[model samples]
Target: MQKKGHRDSYTTNNQKGTVAITDDTVKLPKIGHIKAKFPAKINGLIKSATVSKDPTGKYFVSLLVETIVEPLPKTHSNIGIDLGLTDFIVLSDGSKVANPKFLSKLQHKLAREQKILAKRRAVAKADQRKLSDSRNYQKQKVKVAKVYEKITNIRKDFLHKLSFNLIKNHDVIAIEDLNVKGMVKNKKLAKAISDSSWSTFTTMLNYKAEWYGKKLIKVDRWYPSSKTCSGCGHLLTKAELPLQVRSWDCPSCQQKHDRDINASINILNEGLKLATIKTVGTTGLA
Candidate 1:
């Protein structure tokens, strides 16, 4: 009751927090002057900073540094990456990122804890009737929390590695702008789509591109990236693309399509066109 009801006390009694600006040492809330992993070296002046705890209970300090990175001579060879269920990511550069389905493998353990948590919830409610101590209930909650934490850590590690590799190697990366909400609504392939981790991949790619002096291109969600024939640039008029159809030849172009690679090429071209427009002082391009 106190934990749930005493919101005011929680904030008021929190330890003092301060952001460490560039060249200025500021004391952290609980931990004092811990050195930053890497000083943000930027072209311009330093700005405000924010520190927060993530859902997995990890504390992170975010430095908002004022900076300008002059883009390198444009590579002119932009590549698009298609996130996948089986292969994880298929890049136009012919690079493949293997899908390590962390959640699927951990489902049994997660389900076990969830089942236990459900049972504990019932017990907690019964105890509420008896006005009993919540020590065991709290323990069960922690067990469930630990499983979630493990899942999050696995995801973070995978994303960081994937993002770093892409940013390091590619000059301009293009991806399909995914409407996760809309994709989730399709119950048929929802699990596979979620497991593909397109949302996470896009988010990581976006931030990493900024940090690594790479350009990110986000094509429209509705754009027929997948259905378009990469070689001939012909649109596919198929009513439905089955999940099982890994490769197909375009009816119009007769070009064989490796589904993911075809999508990646379309994304790449779209990104290249957008970059050209931006360079030519166009704010909006149709």
Candidate 2:
């Protein structure tokens, strides 16, 4: 079977290497004669199959069969993921996925260009700031825009691959639906908040789970997915845990906690209910 592009992957297997062409005559294992429509043709050996759409406005299919499962093995190990400003996701499995510090990394160039833009704006020109209409300002704007875009893309790619890896190795996944929009209201953290892309990471995880036949369990928007203890099931009073305290010891269990790991544990537990109910869990949403 020939491989297809990442965005439009397809594979065909069987002695015929193709299914007979016809409307409402698709071949699948066990259920040999099934139904389909345009762009859905018989391809490859019969197997459990499904078709679906994507956010980008496209259709695709996935087939499960006995031939091969590729290197993507299901490890059945689970991890709780904590969302934060100091870090992106802290896994309950004790693996820390560091937040790339995107804004911090790109801050120098951003500040420089922004300063230039500010200087241009301060000129107070009636015709518009000289810098606003100037060729150099426009050039800087493009440069800055591209940098912003590049950083955003880098974050997205990294998050998607990470989520995919998690789905491949684990039986279940847990995460928080952060109050991102509300948190961004803080003037000081707004830029860093925008760069974090916590929501985007969750989006990738949501769909990847479904595609891979894994579980994406979401705790709740209001639940403190982070401030609870996974080991002792003890919750710190809201004032007990402060933003800067990245590490602590659970009072009840006496287990030392890395903020992310603890949050992850809470998420894992909360996600269990979701794993059992399709209507409850939204671990991954494309």
Best by lDDT: 1
The residue ranges of model 2 lying beyond 4 angstroms of the native Cα positions read 1-73, 117-134, 277-286
Q: What TM-score does each of the candidates earn?
A: 0.74, 0.63
Model 2 pairs in collision: 13-44, 13-45, 205-284, 206-284, 206-285, 216-283
What number of backbone clashes does candidate 2 have, counting pairs of residues 3 or more apart or in separate chains? 6
- Misplaced by over 4 Å in model 1 are 1-77, 129-132, 240-243, 282-286
- The per-model lDDT (C-alpha) reads 0.71, 0.69
Model 1: worst 10 consecutive residues (lDDT sum): 5-14
lDDT of 1: 0.71
Give every collision pair in model 1. Answer: none
Question: lDDT per residue, candidate 2, 1-286, as tens digits?
Answer: 2233223444444434243334655564344655556433434345444544432334545554444333446786877787776767778777777779876887898788778756555554544655546766566556666666667767777887888888888978888777889989999998787788877878888877776777788778788766777777788976899877878888898989877777787888778766666654544442
Tens digits of per-residue lDDT, candidate 1, 1-286, equal: 1343222121112232343433445445555576555544434443544565543344556555566665444454567888777888888876788888878878899899889867877887876743136666556666777787787788878888888777777788888787887888899869777866778878888887887678898888788888888888777665656657778888777888888888888888888898787867754543
